[model samples]
Target chain A: MTSLTPMVAELVDYYDDGEAARHFQFRLLDQQQWPPPEPGQFFMLSVPGAGEIPLTFTQLPDQNQHWWALVRRMGSVTSALFRLEPGAILGARGPFGRGWPRPGSDQTPVLLIAGGCGLAPLVSQAERLLEMNLGPVALIYGARSPEARVLGRERDRWQHKLALFEVIEQSPGQTARRTPLDALPDVLAHWGHEPGATFMCGPEAMMTALSQRLIERGIPPSSIWLSLERRMHCATGTCGHCYLSHRYVCQSGPTFGWPELELLMQQPVTTQTPPLLSC
Target chain B: MIHYRLAELAELTRHLGRTRQVWQRSGAKEWCQADASNPPPLEAGRSVQSAKGFFFAEQEHIFEFDGRYFRETLPKPAPFALIGVSSCDLVAIAYQDQFFASDPHYQARRQQALLVGLECTVPCEHGFCPTVDAGPAARPGTSDLVLHPVGNGWLLTVTSEQGRKSLQGLNLTTAPEAMKQQRQAQLADCERQFPDDQHIRDGVQALNAGTVNASTWQQMGVQCLSCSGCTSLCPTCSCYGVQDQSADQTITRRRFWDSCLYDGFQREASQHNPSDDAGARVYRFWYHKFSDDFRKDFGRYGCVGCGRCEATCPGVIGIHSVMKRISQHD
Candidate 1:
């Protein structure tokens, strides 16, 4: 059986330097022991200097020769991971946290709204949906800058099954960048009219605004699921670090339906327990 | 095998002699042995510290990170008798059995431990054993042997197979009827000195009943420096952090005690901190202690009311005092 601990793996490919586009295939010499990852799961990546961080799986092919993580270089771990060469090793563990809920069926349209690096994990969701022949799927990705947009090569592969929309944060020379908040009106105008299960991820502000707008526009909170970012040290439930109220985001969710967010938004912030160390 | 009269209990340390060594957790340094005639010999009412240190050590080496490979090496398990452990800690030990021995990683150390439980003859300053229903006496089966103070000697009640073997070399005889009466009398005195159990339980309930708001936290959060002192010293708090170290062509897994009070505790890789402020940090601590889910996970309240948090707080933010203050407003 494969260990749950994060192990060192060499960086096999690099897509972009500035953008968070890198393919990490763990140095899995023995393929049989590596269990296949579920579609929407993630792993906790730990870099030497940078602390341990969470990343989602992008691809799971027939041969379990290598596992891939599509990481956006936003913080220390990803940024450090980006600097490594093809042979550079980074630590990884999991295929953790529940990913996207299984598709409902062909009758229901699948709406995938990604803001910035939010597109990283959803690409896998989109890919798996297509692999499983689950349809009809549409993707509307919003980024602060066009340069920061992810998965340009995969975009063409998904063109047949996915109706792709890449909304630039600043459509160059424009005074202000058009954030998801600004594009909400247009996104809703296009995909909002359709009745479908909408999955969203990105910065909290964008997701919060989109979720709120979608709720107001009569989208039932039950049909929408949002991926949130909370502080998580032990992506395992051990450290009270990743906890939100009674739930562990690392365990209970990095994803929650619209109905759950309604409760979370209303819940007041509270202090947490102190660290456990017996002196 | 040397027995002492009830009044002569203060002289028990004379047997320990003038050159007994005090074990310190810090490095290999040892404190000078206490003069047997100077301070009163160690009594079992309340230990200067808790039994937590015996199992869940402080500043433990979970794993070491070196380049591309990480190796996890568990410390050799140490065997020692917890001479002054209270019933509350014994119950906590029962819970620890599930946490450590139930899992493979934790069981690595727990299986090596020898638990020596003792009956509490006196109450600590903040302890309310009867209220929580965990105190004042050992629950027959939790400990290896429970030592009770008798008229002129100690009454050792052997509970487990280990208990019987531990006393093999010692000369102990079945106590007479008079000794049993004295044991009962000592227990009664402790019970009399303890306040009504209902008040402690009610106080906790009321604290739970109060509204948890930013303002309520502000009252306590201001003094907190996000230091994890309280949880570090708590006997029952069991939150931990897992780390993976990869180096030397090997991967090792590690679990370290974690606290919610620290800023990084609830930090996400995305830099979106949930308990970002002192208010949220403080709220997380109390709610985890009083909430049903926390108790359900551990099978008991995390706080043993040891007051180590009270003693170590830089701002002197006592959890009991905070609960009482919050209850007063409720």
Candidate 2:
């Protein structure tokens, strides 16, 4: 809606998430108005001399007028973002793509699954659900190790609002090295699989595997959603960098139903068959 | 339709040159934009470089950050006119018009320019515009002015009010009805000259039917050097990347054309790439052009059939070659 032009933002707060991840709070400098970002939507963050990269919103704009981004030190722009201080200024565009589906009613069951730093968007959703007084929410998170678990300081606050499960692959004090898939059955069993909406974000393989398991367990593909990440430049549909068949992940989605993901997963290259053109 | 004698057309070019830049295809492969003191003769085939960059610039500053605030750097180009654009290129521009309808940067330049289309009476060496519905003759609504060359003069059909207004001071006579018949005859004759493009039809059908297997793309990808020549010369390939450069206390964020053939185009920060294989990237590139899914959105295949990709690709994996390979191998 805002196109691809970025607005300058000043870093207002900074938080370290173990070794590989960091979170920054940026306040918009340009007074231009934009619709508030939905959870799972993202922004293109630009650091001087580094370039632009798409980062999902970890937390939406709060009362202090700050938007949060969780950065994993992966490439030039993200690595540059990790080195910035609180007073630094950067450019941001978007709040692009469709976000996760909201609950239909207060009693709707919401299950959130996140792996590693994929927890960012889910955290935002969890916070919103809590504020809305949405019922029966649960979060199942998986990390490689105990130290790799992000948002460690906020777990106490989250536990009070909704059920939170942390599955670690390898840690000295942990009894099991279960992956998200291993932990999913028990989580679903606890919920009694009462036909509620499920959302997941993580590695593609993990999401694919988990979605299939859910489908096998009688969950409708449309009722399950996942957040997708792709190499994006212009968040608008014009740039072809983020295309998945006919869909531009930046515009048509960053979030999509499991049925759509299944369609995307089935075709490795081309788009689905199109209707014939009446010349 | 108006008729302009071959000698009198130059007068119109000279008149328009007084207030705005007049761009016309010059030499064998270039568009010369300046005062039309001596306008070049209209060419028969497509120009080597399509008129894409005039609307969607090759590189543009999207915004600038001066320490504390960001400012948009929308282009403010002077009004200009493109004369003698080929039918294939005109169709491509219209296709882009729909894609960038909401993009302010593209609209900024597009609103300041006028499009003049030239119908092809003869097929170029490698073009198959007819197969893609892009044409040997300009389609209605794609261009402001349509030019059809006759024996001693040109039949200029003013399709838009802007085109009619641009000819205000020039003295032109109404074209004879016989000129329209002659133009249609010429276009039909040119259409029949196009080589057997059954392979393209077959290839597109295979692509839609999901009959072209992965191994064929792998074989084709081996020949691809990833030089980006095809994408660069393509009339409809519109992918780009953005970057920020620091200068003193200010930073400039710019967007430049990017190609899907590159592996890094779809790679994530986690080092996980959906299209990690070279063959897969090659397949995705072609799929974007021939896929039916995009047709539903853009109302046509992305390829305009100008065949410039064939002329520019060093790897010989251009549209014709790839389509031929797919048809043959399958």
Q: What is the DockQ of each candidate?
A: 0.32, 0.44
lDDT of each: 0.62, 0.81
lDDT of 2 by residue, A157-251 (tens): 88787788888877787775578888888877775645478888887678878888988988777889999888887888887878787788988
lDDT (10s digit) by residue, model 2, range B104-192 = 89999999988888888889978999999999989878988888888867878888888878878777777777888898999999999
Point out the worst 10-residue segment of candidate 1 chain A by lDDT.
Answer: A270-279
**Lowest-lDDT window of 10 residues in candidate 2 chain B?**
B1-10
Give the RMSD in angstroms, all C-alphas superposed, for model 2.
4.7
On a 0 to 1 TM-score scale, where does candidate 1 land against the true structure? Answer: 0.82
lDDT of 1 by residue, A1-279 (tens): 223345555566655522655656555432334456666667776776556777776675336447666766666666777777877766666666777787767336777888866776777778767777655677777876767777777787888777777777666677866665566667657754564678888876667777778778777778888786666665656556666666777777788887876665544454343421100
